[model samples]
Target: MNDQTKGIIAWIIIGLIAGLVASLIVGGAGSIIGWLIAGLIGSVVGGFLAQRFDIKLNLGNPFFEQVIVSIVGAIIVLIIAQIIT
Candidate 1:
């Protein structure tokens, strides 16, 4: 697979994981697609926040660190959403 394709697949995987975890934590009753979308958005949010705050996970593995970050972001998004509505 090409680099771009691999990146897309990685993003999707990260999103799915982050979304599911966030749903469980936030008691989400949404659909799979919804979680996926949320997770995707969470990844972006997490990345932005991480960049701004200089957050880094020295877990020796980039993927796992990203998953954690994405999960946190998803949770933040879910919480903010709950408050907004």
Candidate 2:
């Protein structure tokens, strides 16, 4: 696998984990695909919000940091989804 492939895989793993955790925390129902979608969306939104809000989280690990941000973002997405639907 190339660097891009590795990155994609890493992202998928992070997304899946973040989605699962977010769903559990925010209370959501869906399949693996749903979780993945939520996770990916959350990742983007979370990163953007983190930057916009100046949220600084130094977890000492890049991967863990990503997961934490992703989870927080996913929770936000889930909450919005719940309100919308």
Candidate 3:
């Protein structure tokens, strides 16, 4: 696959993992579509937070790094959703 395809696939995987973990932690629930939405949004949020706060992971694996960041971001998203609802 091309670089774009790879990146998209990576993001999906990261989103699934992050969404599930965040939902579990925050006592939120969702379907596959919900998880995907949360995960994608989480990825963006995580990236922004990392850039703003200089968050870094020395996991030596980009996938793991993304997962960790995504999870944190997803948690924040869940909290906001809770507050808003």
Error of model 1, residue 2, in angstroms: 0.9
- Count of clashes, each model: 0, 0, 0
- Per-model TM-score versus the true fold: 0.93, 0.94, 0.93
TM-score (C-alpha, index-matched) for candidate 3: 0.93
> By lDDT, highest first, what's the ranking?
2, 1, 3
- Which candidate, 1 or 2, has the higher TM-score? 2
Candidate 2 residue runs with Cα over 4 Å from true position: none
Q: Global CA lDDT of candidate 2, please?
A: 0.91
After TM-score superposition, the amount by which residue 74's alpha carbon in candidate 1 deviates from its true location, in angstroms, is 0.4
Weakest lDDT window of 10 consecutive positions for candidate 3: 27-36
Query: Which candidate has the highest TM-score of all?
Result: 2
Which ranges in model 1 have alpha carbons more than 4 Å from their true place? Answer: none
Per-model CA lDDT versus the true structure? 0.90, 0.91, 0.87
